[model samples]
Target: MKRFPAAAALLAAVLLLAGCSASGSSNDAGSSVSNPGTGAVTGDGTTKDSGVVGAPQAGDAAGSVTSGSAAGSTSEVATGQRDVIMTGSMSITAKDPIKATQDAVTITEQAGGRIDSRTENPATENQQASATLTLRIPSGALDRTVTDLKKLGTVNFVSLNASDITQQTQDLDARITALKTSVDRLLTLMQQATTTTDLIAIEGTLSQRQADLESLQSQRNFLSDQVDFSTITLSLYSTGTVAPGAPGDFWTAIGAGWAALVGALGAALVGIGYALPWIALVGVLALIVILIVRMSRRKGKAA
Candidate 1:
């Protein structure tokens, strides 16, 4: 009886072990079939996963980090540093337009600025002399330069305007980065290409991307310049002043009047010269009529 019980217990234990092994094998097969080629199958019939496939690899991870940092830096550049285009206009009555313009040029140069355009009108007897100057001033010193300019003459008008291009600049930066990436990818593809046809195609795409990158770079440079420099359009008018003369005022006026009289006489002579030809023609025609009338009268008397 004892031997029978012991044999039964042994058979029961072997069957239990076989059942556990079969269950484990089935679970492993199920895992292999469920998550094929993904990861190692664990004893629990689950995948021992690492990183996900098609995700950013180590090399690409660095680039992603750099891109994120660049994006953050761009955001800061857009928000913290303002891209503002400033323009100003001022009208002043100066005692001398020429001197005022010269002084304005000097001031602008001293302020790390340049004169973009300048126009001067000469003084006339009926009109005051004037000058219009377009100056580009450094934004940092614009206020001080404006104050210095105001001291040159009586200010008639003053205006200032500011335009913000922060969003525009950010958008351009993002576009430039994308274009640069595309250009790099195209260059890589070109290097890898073996056939001439493939090379030509990749080169075309690369050229286009490089062109777009350069264009965006140019726009960024222009925007940066505009933000750095402020425009000032200054209009200066001369205050017409006649100086008091100690010696030559009377003689100068008398000489001027004499010149005017001579000019009038010369004009009258020119008019008479032009009319003389017509007058001569009329006199000749009248003389011819008189002769013809006298001849007709003599003929009638004879008849």
Candidate 2:
């Protein structure tokens, strides 16, 4: 009876030990998974925590973060991703530039683009009708957009430019990441800080870092937009101006020459007619003076 009681107590102890081991394993696994792989998110739904903590002193964090940032930036430069900004300008000639402009607007809209600005000039006696548009088109459809714009009129000039900003973007990203880490460390220090002087200094630094982060993020956003959309300045003009080596018939030239000659002769005749009255007045005065001189001579002879 004594042996049986002892065996039963041993079995109970073994079962309790096994259960405790399983529960501990499960708890540890849950904790590891619940923290998230990236970091902690807050009210703004942004990951603010940099997963860096437990440093002995916060003063040296900035320098360490800068060094790490430099290394990360270098790595980013070597990465395979490419970011480019596309810009272009084109000149097209059409019969009616105003109508072409509308077509261009429609095509751009269909291609998921928008006009940033538009200008139109009505045809004057001295100037041709024209329109200028600044368009923002998706980068993926840049070629297609350009082709569609060409269909609106005869393309006179087309220029496309691309700039690579991958390195700059990567550097900015690395700097932002390092700054976030430094800021996190500063916040932790602020909580553990005991002296008011240290707290004030830390807060001032944190504010500066946050400002810089915000500025960098803005730059990143602008760069991202540039990458997503390409800018194109489209110029549409009526085909009023003739290009060099344009086809011309000899009859047209002869007609122009005949018109010019007729105009020149007409101008000469008008000038002669205007001077006729002045010439007649001088002639009449001469005749009267001659008569008076002759009468005086005759009177002298008689005397």
Candidate 3:
């Protein structure tokens, strides 16, 4: 009876040990399979957190975020850079200075621009007349404006220049905004400016800043105008021509030449006639001086 009880107890202990061993082996095998030869173990026996060597670091969530932001910043800078300033000029020859200038003005207006100034001279001899015009046109229309201007006359000179002024424009804008803020602040503090000395100092500083603001505004307007318009110079000249006479032309030419000579002589005499008073005054002064000296000499001889 004692041997039987001891044998039964041994059998129960062996079964319990076998069951525990089987459960432990099953859990370890599952972990190894999930890791797929990487020797990694996770609480859930899942391979989501484990990766092969050099596997792109699981798609880089934080790095991707930074890269996106940097790309957006670079794109903004490039776009701002594109807002630059460009200049263009053209020279044309026309048959009439006034007509050419008028035509140019019309064209400038049609191109959504205005003429800053126009200079035309018709009284100048040699039939060489010219007009210079400063115009403001949109940058997009610069090329078309030049083409249209060229149609007005023979193109003598054409030039174009482009410069990056984005930085300058931005800086000026910022400065203007700051000056405006300062002006507003000063106005608010006007009641506090009691003492004469303080008042003078404040006024002086305000005046300076106001002047600067005006200057900056003027510059901005000028730049804006330039960006919108192109400058053009037009010159006009007439070709001189002579008419031929019939067979007895030599005699006729001689007679005409003689008449011209007589007329020129008459003009010269008339011009000299207008100068007679000044000429007489100079002569009288000289004679009086000479007579005074001679009379002094005569008086000395008599003594």
- Which candidate's lDDT is highest? 2
lDDT of every model, 2 decimals? 0.66, 0.68, 0.54
At residue 217, candidate 3 shows an lDDT of 87
lDDT tens digits by residue: candidate 1, 149-185:
9999999989999998876765565445544544554
Q: Lowest summed-lDDT stretch of 10 residues in model 3?
A: 40-49
Q: Which model scores highest in TM-score?
A: 1
Considering lDDT, where higher is better, how would the candidates rank from best to worst? 2, 1, 3
Off by over 4 Å in 2: 1-53, 56-80, 241-303
Q: Tell me which of candidates 1 and 3 scores higher on lDDT.
A: 1
Give one digit per residue, the lDDT tens place, for model 2 in 1-303. 755554443333333323433343233223221122121111111211222233434334433444455555556556855789999999999999999999999999999999999999978644778999999999999999999899997999999999998766765665556546646755775675444554565566567657767886899899999999999999998996653333367887688679879999999999999999999999999999999999999999999
Cα error, candidate 1, residue 235 (Å): 0.7
Alpha carbon deviation, residue 198, candidate 1 (Å): 0.6
What residue runs in model 1 are displaced by over 4 Å at the alpha carbon? Answer: 1-70, 77-79, 240-303
Candidates' TM-scores? 0.61, 0.57, 0.54
> How many steric overlaps does candidate 2 have?
0
Q: What is candidate 2's TM-score against the reference?
A: 0.57
